[model samples]
Target: INFNDIKEWKAALCLLRSSPNLVELEMLARPEEDNLVRPGVSFWAESNQFDCPFDQLRVVRIVDVVGIRPELDFVKFLLANSPSLEKLTVKPVSNDGGLDLLKELVRYRRASIQAEVIYVDP
Candidate 1:
């Protein structure tokens, strides 16, 4: 689960999906040996599938999210799916549009859900 391979990441998601009672999900994506050959493609795709069957999930923390379309989509998906979600923490490595992402989430927060997003710029 510590590797950057796409297959491994997908497998992790499948495993996670099986757990319907998961209340918290944390994900960290690190490059393989500091190799920048790929520009966050693997993480992006994995993020898109972040919508697990965690009906009671309230916390989701993502660290080191690089600039990837799937990552953005994943965050949006979480905001839409996790009605009980209350907190979201994002730690970005660079200027990866983290603020804009949070704003979007805030804009879409439902009146019934008191969602708070804490963005830590790194």
Candidate 2:
């Protein structure tokens, strides 16, 4: 899913909300042109009205993350909602802000005591 696209991102969230039995999930962000303007609204935070938890989801992998607020919010949402999640891996588009990204990710509350957030270089 392209996190930069509001419609696509919303659709992805809707899919997640409906897929309570999802086990492993992966999101790959295709690098977009730098000239494009980023969305100003924090959709994840605003649309966080999930009624069901991701009970069966265990693993998740997100690639090409750029440390955007929306991306971070989405990660935080998943961590706080997916009680069965064992591991969530995030691979940045580059090493820039990687440490800060990792720090921010760890600050979010986790629903699963065993859930581990891994940050990797691209």
Score candidate 1 by lDDT.
0.63
In TM-score terms, candidate 2 sits at 0.89
Stretches > 4 Å off in candidate 2 = 34-40
> Would you list the clashing residue pairs of candidate 2?
none
| Index of the highest-TM-score prediction | 2
Candidate 1 lDDT score at position 24: 91
In model 1, which regions exceed 4 Å deviation? 1-9, 31-52, 96-98, 104-112
Q: Write the per-residue lDDT of candidate 1 for residues 1-122, one digit (tens) a residue.
A: 33445566567667667867878989885545544325646563346455554467788898887644545545665665676778877777677677776576566543226667778787
TM-score of model 1 vs. true structure: 0.64
What TM-score would each prediction reach against the true structure? 0.64, 0.89
What digit string (tens of lDDT, one per residue) describes model 2 on residues 12-114? 9889888878999999876555423256777777665757589999999999898877788889888888899999999999999999999999999999999
lDDT of 2 at 91: 97
lDDT of 2 at 93: 91
What's the CA error at residue 13 for candidate 2, in Å? 1.4
